[model samples]
Target: MAKFALLIGVSEYQPGLNALPGAVQDIKAMQRVLQHSEMGDFADADMTVLENPPRHVMERAIENLFSNRQKDDLVLFYFSGHGIKDDSGKLYLSTSETSKYQSGELIQTTATAASLIHGMMERSRSRRQVIILDCCFSGAFAEGMKAKDDNTVDIKNQLGGEGRAVLTSSTATQYSFEQEGEDLSVYTRYIVEGIEKGAADTDNDGMISVDELHEYARKKVQEAAPAMKPEIYAVREGFKIKIAKAPVGDPQLEYRKEVEQCVRNGKVSVIGRRILKRRQSELGLSVEVAAQIENEVLEPYRQYQANLREYEEALAEALQHEGTLSQHTREELKRFQQLLQLRDEDIDLIEVPVAIEKDTIKQSEFLYQKSTETLIYKLRHQLVDITSTEIELAEQKEYKDEGLFERFTERAIEAIRLAQEETLRFGHNFIGTEQILLGLIREETGVAAQVLQLKGIKLADTRIEVEKIIGLGSGFVPPELPFTPNAKRVIELSLEEAKTLKHNYVSTGDLLLGCIRLEEGVAVRVLENLGVNLQNLREQVVHTINLSKNKNIQSQ
Candidate 1:
């Protein structure tokens, strides 16, 4: 069967339209896969590429690419550029000749219309037609779309009947995004990666179907750019249309897959070790290998330092303009400030060596140091007493926190903040273990809550039980209540629990387990009174954590 592809990209637009740097890159990436022998296998002559083409050129390319094709022939059309909707609600693909600021009434004339391409694809003799648009409001390419009420099965059934499909980078209203420091747009980056890395083949079938490609790219782009959502509209059941052939026997790519999985699971430390282990297993940890791994680690380390400073500066600005900031923005600034403070402590730990007396838990001590901000950032190995600094350095090896907040997932941070709110609600001067328990309960969607639900425990019942056990506190509540010693210990042990479970983040489950393991807090007493079998409950929590992790992997 004859196969063809028309790849269009516009990186340079007229004065009125903003230029996109990644448009050209997107075109080149797709061209590579479409022409790869193992993938699309389209001959170089069969693939047409238009870079910054004018309105007429783009229209002619689309029309000619789809014209006079056989019923079984596959025709694929992809566009990467700016898509703008006119006042009349007609979507136009901005061309090199299009100047939104100066064209005035000629805007429609200077750009290719989405409806024109849709009409051409619908009318094409080819039974299998695929349109992929990567631009702002690209979803507009799908004409006559009904209300989005169908599931994957329904979409598959419809596509199976029609053999026509349209994929867009984002919804008709949302803007497609580019990565912060990458050369490709967020949507296109994943699209290229999915094809290149064989990740789009969800079933290990060695074939990347249109549906699989869209699903893989959609999930990835959503992860990297949460604001943009990719869409798939199938006119009939071409869902199984083979887009690419998966690669095999590539060990480096396989290892990179592991690294990606670790990232999704929030296993930041595992990333460095994975790199180190891969190097050692493949090349032995020679000087060159160590240097390479160190360079890799150092890039992110330096980036973390830069990011920490940026967050600090933003916090400073927010503080200066505190009166004009919204409550939500102010709260964000506060949380960011705390994160920066935590990062500074991490850097200091790397710079200075601390003496640990009678502590087998080096990680726990690190957390304590981070909480207290033991050394000022400026005091990076520059203490007043050079002799003491020398002695301390001689006594112990250096340590680094390695992106202090990376270990904590977004949910974990929310749980901690909720715990503080619990402390305030109880009118307590300090956060206690009971407050931590309440915080976990209040994190309704947390794994801890899920496990507790299986045991017939509810947040409301737990809150009542907690109040009865703690009794009412005095009306006086401090605005800046610190964690009580027990609470601090619980937090430390929670980190240990996370490490022991081989999980990266200190999850709500870890917090609950930590409180129970402490064995001397009001939290423990409450759980005991409620007739909880601590051992079984802990096991259930671990199981739930694993199940959630697996679910995330499968979804991705």
Candidate 2:
């Protein structure tokens, strides 16, 4: 019996029908195997190859192949092109002329009806008929055939015909795919491998059968294009027609399978090393192709390593502080250490503890639970807030004077130091406005003390009253004590008070005026409790500032 094969592949197509350069390669690969001397062993004269043929030419070729065929002749038809389903659900092998506009009509005219091919194959004189299709939704070719058999149904049971079979690249709902940078479609490549290399002999037989070929191609295609599932349909018990004689094996495929299995299992480093060793060269793959495969697996790992390096560098820089860490820096170190599983040995540059003291009186550390950066920022803002005088409906200019900050009078600086000392003596972690008031009262010869003395507000009595309002706190003195917000506000107001009085240097008089003008705080309440008239206190503080300013002016 003569074996006749017709191969049709379309790479060029009309607009809206994407061109398939792989389709041409697919047909050529299949033709090679079929015409091979010991494989398919079919004569070249018996094979018909068409590239980008029109619809009429394809119809004539199909007719001529099946019409004059003898009963015992074997007819194999293969198509690698675009398979599309119309609105009526009929499948069509799209031609080069297929277009999106009036797609159903265009497909009907330019494409071959898959059902028509099935009908023609059934009516053909030859019972030994095989139709192989490697196109999107090619499984639609066997849509009408159904039987009580499993995936390997006998063709006679489904179509009630002997020696008729169909093999498709993908299921009706699936789109066959082409690998990026590869010349063949995923399904067709495996089909070619099955025919040429004899990997289709799943049962270890000496020949490659149609069922075995489908089994091998389906599995390989699924591995390459996970979304596709190749299918096969057959008639009668003669479905196991040996298409190709089996070669010993394709060692290239064997190595590729191992590499692919490693990739699937996430063994990137192992695969990367293997690829660098040029192990893929055994499979006839070039160094560039191997590198491409390696890069795909290693790209994510490389990114993670890069990020890890940056993280480690940041963590190392944080560890190099001389004194106590800022609460923000401490917390960052803590989180990073946890993430990287960093041990003491990993960061041996410093002998310091990574954690910040949780209950410390240091304002930055104390506010760490709330937010370190915010508290420091707010504190820094107080510098501006304190130095500026507020006027009703007046635009305030931002003053940034580092010199003015360093030019505080010696007595004024001494008073602030005393306030911090008094806070510690009172077993308080924070230096409140009350402590600042005590500092002003205790600076005995300062203009504030002299003014208070004239107003019958003695230092001893004021201290007693201050202590009464604020009882002693727990004696947990931290290494560094920061002023309370109220105290810091009082200091800011003192700077504003000095500016308002036209004094270049802040004094005890400015401190007292700032305390009196401060709307809220224990200082205001204590002065009020002592029945000190705020208007008179303001007058006395302003008069003291004038007297000092005049003395300086006179001395100059």
Candidate 3:
């Protein structure tokens, strides 16, 4: 029996539809796997790919895919694009020319209807047919079909054939999602990964059946995005149709599956580690080999978590400056999302709640504004006088041309060194505000440590809170860790505080002031969680600085 396939990818759409840049890439990926000699074994001339085809071109292609095929021939049709359903619930696969009215009504004539594809499928002589759809509302193509014994739609009844299979990226009512930072849609990515890695050959029979491929892709898609539920439909012997060949008795594949089971929330569980150790011995693989495989398996999860943390930190810093995000901040955030390869949906999950929390705090503060205005006014006047005296003293001292490093006191420098150590301890590659706070507390002789201790924020408790907030990193710390933007801002603010306090060198007290000044940083969050009163803490640090200044003046 010969194999023939047609793949359609629609990326450019009319004004009414959003562009899907990944759709074309999806077609390329599928083509690669389907033409692999050891896998799909389909001849190059037997496979066809159409990218961003117009409605008529797409319709003709679909007709040709199922036309003139023998009963024993294997026919496959794949589409990745927008899937729209009309009010009557008929699904249409969109094309480059697909458009909708301003009222949000679909222009049916502008797209290829599923009914046409079904008609083509019914007229095909080939019994071995596979239809794979990676698009929104894709499952709706099986509408009006009978349910099989397994409760899945009967493709034979809908698309019409004794031996047929259909796989959709999402349920009838759900939308198929494109993963951010990925070259293919979430469903298609797993599908390609399964075929390329031979992980779909679950039974180790060296063959990847259509049903097995769908099952493997479904589990992986759900793991990455639980809201998505990929569906598969088959009838008669369709479920047993072998789509590709897998490497049998592959030790790496065996180990990879075990590692998948061990991974949870992006990290290997303690029990999972023990299980992996035992599996390694049984598989007769060396420790280094197993570790390499496990790392490969875990990389995706770790990358996702890292993206989330980076976005969260950037959002937190932005929220500190204003209750409502300015246009500039919004643009900055968008850049962050793109740079971090995060999806809009994923970012919404982190941003919405944080914004609501900030709004709630603003509302509560407004309620007390009237009562605190007079006290705030008095404090401001007092601070002005203190600032004037400090500035006069600061000017009296001779200035030196030196870098920021030369301006730091020995204790301040030690605290920074401790910050890098803390970063390594947390397995993180960057020093963030939380690490800086830990460093300050660890430098026991620094004034920042003294103030923190007096406020009941112990080093041990702070460490716990820091871990709870940011968690451990991916365990690949670089030789030289960089400082996060917030961390760098803290150092800049500390230098300003030192200059304002008439200290030629940046002291630990100045660093503490800088941390307090950064209202939105992880450091401030930890301090608040530890029950430290920030305003009072700031006043105490200033008061202590004044007392030290007076003692020095008297001794001189």
Per-model lDDT: 0.63, 0.63, 0.74
- Tens digits of lDDT, candidate 1, 96-189: 8876545444357888766777678767888788878786552211111111111111222222237877777876555464433457776787
- TM-score rank order: 3, 1, 2
RMSD in Å for candidate 3, one decimal?
18.5
lDDT (C-alpha) at residue 292 in model 3: 91
**TM-score for predicted model 3 compared with the true structure:** 0.55
Give me the displacement of residue 191 in model 3, in angstroms: 0.2
Q: Candidate 3 residues 1-556, lDDT tens each?
A: 8999999998888895667778899999999999999888889999999999999999998898889999999999999988776776667788899988998778889988788899998899999999998875532212112010011232334554569988988776554766445688878898988899898888889999999999989877765555467888788888988898998778888888888889887789999999999999999999899989887777656766776788888897788877568998898787566445455556655663344344334343442343334533433343332223333343476323123444555556667678878888888888888988898899875567766765678888998999999999899966546677888788789888878878655767788899999998999999999888898778767655554444331100
lDDT of 2 by residue, 77-141 (tens): 88888776566556677667765565334446777776677677777889788778776542221
Q: What are the C-alpha RMSDs, in order, of all predicted structures?
A: 14.9, 26.9, 18.5
Worst 10 residues of 2 by lDDT: 141-150
Error of 1 at 472 (Å): 24
The top-ranked prediction according to TM-score is 3
